[model samples]
Target: MKDAEKLAAFCATIADERKADNIVQLKLADISTVTDFFILCTANSEPHLRAIADTIVRDAREKLKVRPRKVDGKPASHWIIIDYTNVLIHIMTNEMRELYQLESLWGDAPTVSAIKTLRKKTPA
Candidate 1:
């Protein structure tokens, strides 16, 4: 897999470990110039949102040697956006996620099986 794909999968895995809901990785390379992939997931609450975002950032840096170039939003806002140059991670509460509906906004972009990719890379 490509570096960005691997990073996306790795971020998804970290989010899953934090019990993030509705995890999705969207391939935006063909449709958008802003980023290549977008990893979006819903958190149960503000603390959950913080945990998911923090874990993704921390683990991605420690394990993959990658850190987001920027992080936007906050737990209190019910949304957090971590920008890793080629991949963007969105951690949001259900309400925020519903309101934004990023999936619908990027409907034309294809979804990638990020969890499956992580599982394949992980040893049982």
Candidate 2:
């Protein structure tokens, strides 16, 4: 499957496991230096975070036949980033999410979905 199609399946898989509060897809195809898309989301806690990460790993492998080239922040469970060549997944806490301000930093990226943002911000 194509990267975009695989990405969609990955997001839905994570959502099915209830590990993600919202999964937002940002197409960064135009940004040559950066990945093609940004997958930003939140997890309820450490276990939930792990579940999401695991889901992404499994789905990417089983469906796309691809895997993240590298991963970061797996130790803290605060923020976990799974980096595929053409996409990046950011699973973070509410405070960390705001502090990092990734969305603001990548303000130029076009948002393809507002799934988790539809409701008011809920505290974890």
- Indicate which candidate wins on lDDT: 1
lDDT of 2 by residue, 17-47 (tens): 6647767777777754777778888876778
Predict model 1's lDDT versus the native. 0.87
Q: How accurate is candidate 2 locally (lDDT)?
A: 0.73
The C-alpha TM-scores of every prediction are: 0.89, 0.80
CA lDDT of each prediction against the hidden true structure = 0.87, 0.73
lDDT of 1 by residue, 1-124 (tens): 3999999988988888888878999999999998999999888889989888888888888988987899999889999999999999998888988998999999999999644222333576
lDDT of 2 at 113: 71
Report the error of model 2 at residue 47, Å. Answer: 1.1
The 10-residue segment with the lowest total lDDT in model 2: 1-10
What's model 1's lDDT at 72? 97
